[model samples]
Target: MPTALAIAAFSPSVLLDVATTVRAADLRDWDIRTVPATSSPQVFGDLADGAVDAALTSPDNVLLYAGPADNPLGRMLDLVVPVTVDRGLDLSLWARPGLGALVDLDAPVLAVDVTASGYALAAFALLAQRGWTRDRLNVVSLGATPKRRAALIAGACDLTILNAGNELLAHAQGATRIASVDELGPYLGSVLCRSAHLDGERAGGVAAVGQALTATASEILAGEHDDLVTASAQRLLGLAPALADAYLTVLRSPAAGLVGDGRADPAAVRTLVDLRGASDLRRGVDVLSAAGIH
Candidate 1:
């Protein structure tokens, strides 16, 4: 029997992409697992508790978990980021049907995770760019993308950031994307985080995982797995064929999709630091190199 490789993540596409890549790599002996973590904290918790081997999370989480401060776990994790799944910002803030203008958004009561969540960090950055702050808006601590989507439709919140195939569904529902993380400088969106617990020959699996992810990314960038990817979008995200195609378009774009070579670039690292507004966290080339982000 093969060892189970479990990964905690948020986006449906990342899970699907990893599965596709793993299959393509002929790693039939490995039993892959994915848990859609309610929030970044949950993802980290799962990792710490030995419930999951690795995670697909942001660089901010990497820093905080491996840090000197601001970690929810209150301890440092020896995380190795060998590859980045999505190179671009897949997050987009969607508004209800009547909300066509930015100024029109009021109280806002935006539906997203707590201040520590990845969505909250990116949302805060966008809001700050618009001369707004987190204190000004009421952000609810919601978990899971489906709940957020339902909350938006039910008028529970004024806005929320949707990623991967979620944005496609939001578009189909007549909700408009008022803002995007794309406007912000290089967001290091999602990367492959591996546990340092594995030793000897077991540790080699991390490199295999990275190579599989890189292969998948190359297929996505080259549009080689359109049917498979589109089918995945439909099944995993409940997206229609047209919406799946739209998601595929984003996935295939050289600017908006996965990292082709599996290495996390330094510029994206700098952007992630700026996006989190954590300049004092001892971030730079050296830190990234130490974290296996290069």
Candidate 2:
């Protein structure tokens, strides 16, 4: 049976990396049923329930679900990360183009789902850096990057964070990036994770996918095969030529890309934990290791 892979964002940041890595592994025959990125609950919950073999999601989801305090599902299931997708934070805070400066940004609304999303936590940190409180902007709970992107473009919300193909699309639409998570330093973005309950063929499939993802990260970091990268972004994320180009430019840069060895940076993971106000969670390191990254 083909391994079922659910993606939270389903963008090139993921699709291209998977495709390149799988191709490098010569696992072309590997059948993977792709479920589009949706709300984290629906996707990660499926993994927790064993409905899906594995998924690509933020480390925040993994930690939140693994933790004792906020795990809504009651019983905590081990979310094993087989590979790390992005080592550095690949997010940008964008707003309507008309604003002259960050001060002119009277953005009364910040469109992001604060419910169980690490990006939302990072958004709050960015706001603090700018001397603004969470109350400064009315946070709108919206799932999926495209929905958030649309909200920012339509001025439904004055600001939101975007990454990968979504960031390029937002930029092309005149949503200017005012601040980036990169500036904040070391934010773990995404990972390929699975439940500890997986075994037999399921476990083998997870390993294969992890190997492919690791290979994909290596190729991306090497920054070769521009055409392949661009095509994958366009096909998977439905980005226009210009947007695809922009995505590639960023992907090839040293600022951000895949985590070449699938090992999650401890500092980066720690940064996320601190941002989420879960610093006292001592077992976090063990949890991060269970995800196959440390």
TM value for model 2: 0.88
Candidate 1 local lDDT, 1-294, one digit each (tens):
777777776766543454545464466656667777788778877776667777777766776676655577776666667777675435788886567566766667788865676567778778778876877888787876767877777777788887767777777777778788777766666777765665534446555666677777786676577777778878877888888788788776666677777666777777766666655556333435453333
Question: For model 2, how does the per-residue alpha-carbon lDDT over 1-294 read when each residue is reduced to its tens digit?
Answer: 334543334343544354545474455535666666667776667887777777777887778777655655655666677777774435878876564666765655777755557888778788789887887777888877777888888878888887867777777788888788877777778888788787667767767777776776677668756677777777877887777777766655555766777787887887777777765455545667655543
Task: Return the top candidate by lDDT.
Answer: 2
- lDDT values, one for every candidate: 0.69, 0.70
**Clash pairs, model 1 backbone:** none
Q: How much does each candidate deviate from the true structure in C-alpha RMSD?
A: 2.6, 2.7
Candidate 2 residue 245 C-alpha distance from true site, Å: 2.9
Q: Which sections of candidate 1 miss by over 4 Å?
A: 14-25, 100-106, 199-202, 283-294
Worst 10 residues of 2 by lDDT: 1-10
